[model samples]
Target: MKVVIFSTCVVDLEFPNVGKAMVEVLERFGCDCYLPSDQICCGQPTYNSGYEKGTQRTFRNQVDALLSVESDYIVGPAGSCVAMLREYPELLKDDPEYLGKARILAAKTYEFSQFLWRILGVENAGAELNGKATYHRSCHMTRLLGEAESPYALLEHVKGLEMVPLANAHDCCGFGGTFSAKEPEISKQMVDEKVRHIEETGAEILVSCDPGCLMNIGGRFNRLGKPIKIMHLAEVLNSNVDERRITYLKQMPV
Candidate 1:
């Protein structure tokens, strides 16, 4: 399968290793991956800040960039950004020039874990991590993107990883893109509560599918002098992989 990597702004600028892990995992599953240099931010920061009209160009640019290469799918590491990409058709519906193109782009885009479990039928990526870790369900990944199971499903098969059930796993991690910047005090309080729950789990590692949440919760743990390690879902799945244990539900199509 020909796949294009949708490296979100945060992954490109801040968490580059997450993007690398995503590509590595996809390539391991027999995908021919391509990273288009023309790709940019998915416009969530500006769009969520009530600049809908101003984000139109960004929406169009992303559609053009991802489609620049002929591919079967566009996969991104961040569920929050992939959810934003899935919104392009509606966001650009009035644009006669790009509306159809936006629809096509949205249809092919999938979040990393979602693609692994759903499209690729990967039940196990042969990853092994020795520690108790709790998962933070990002607001956009669950509520907005409606992907509540894909990450957990894949995580279940990781050898030696003990997945702890986070208390109030549905709560937001207080990293709503621009919401964190505009309401830092409130955001801090929300993330503080999230960290408390994580600490309650007695988990040595905190895992989340969204980089924004990891940044928020991990930053709080750092400032508070807690020793929790933060990891993205892709990083967790790509770690200590055992080639002999890697198994898929079905074979890749020819």
Candidate 2:
């Protein structure tokens, strides 16, 4: 099947390797994957901040970029961005020209975990990792995208891996994109609480599907000298016992 890698803006900028790791996992499954270089932000921040007009440009660009390749699926690593992509139909409903294309793009888009566990029927990508890891359920991935179970299902199949339940796994990491910047104090408090819970789990690593959350919580941990390693789900899934063990050790704050 033809798959388009819709690596969102954050992964493109800060964690480019995560996007590559995602492609690595996809290729392992024997799928032809193409990275759409011209793709930009899904206009989520602008749309969330009540700037509808600004969303149109990014929306149009993304629609044209993804639809240009007649692929079977457009898969992304971030749930929030994919959720925004899914909203394009409503965002452009009044504009008859792009409305149908928006819906088609929305229908074809799939979050990484959702595609792996649900669509691709891949519970195990034959990856192996030795760690007690906990997953932080990004709000958009769980509540908005309704993909609460796929990540866990995939994690369960990883050889030599131990998945633990995160306390208050559903709580927000206070990195609601602009929310962290707008309300630094509140965001700090929220992420601090999140870090505390993560520590309580006693897991060597904290895994999340969203880059924003990982950056926010990981930044707080870094400033406070917390040693916990923060990682993207794709990175973990693309790893083996030797690679993952070294990763955990290397990421430990010195």
lDDT of 1: 0.91
* lDDT (Cα, tens digit) per residue for candidate 1, span 72-165: 9999988899999998888998999999999999999999998999899998999999999988988898887999988998899989899999
Candidate 1's TM-score: 0.97
On lDDT, the candidate that comes out on top is: 1
Runs in model 1 deviating more than 4 A are 250-254
For residues 144-174, write the lDDT of model 2, one tens digit per residue.
Answer: 8877887887777777778788888878999
| Number of the top TM-score candidate | 1
Worst 10 residues of 1 by lDDT: 245-254
How many clashes in each candidate?
0, 0
How far is 246's C-alpha from truth in model 2 (Å)? 22
Error of 1 at 79 (Å): 0.8
Determine the C-alpha RMSD for candidate 1 after optimal superposition of all C-alphas: 2.1
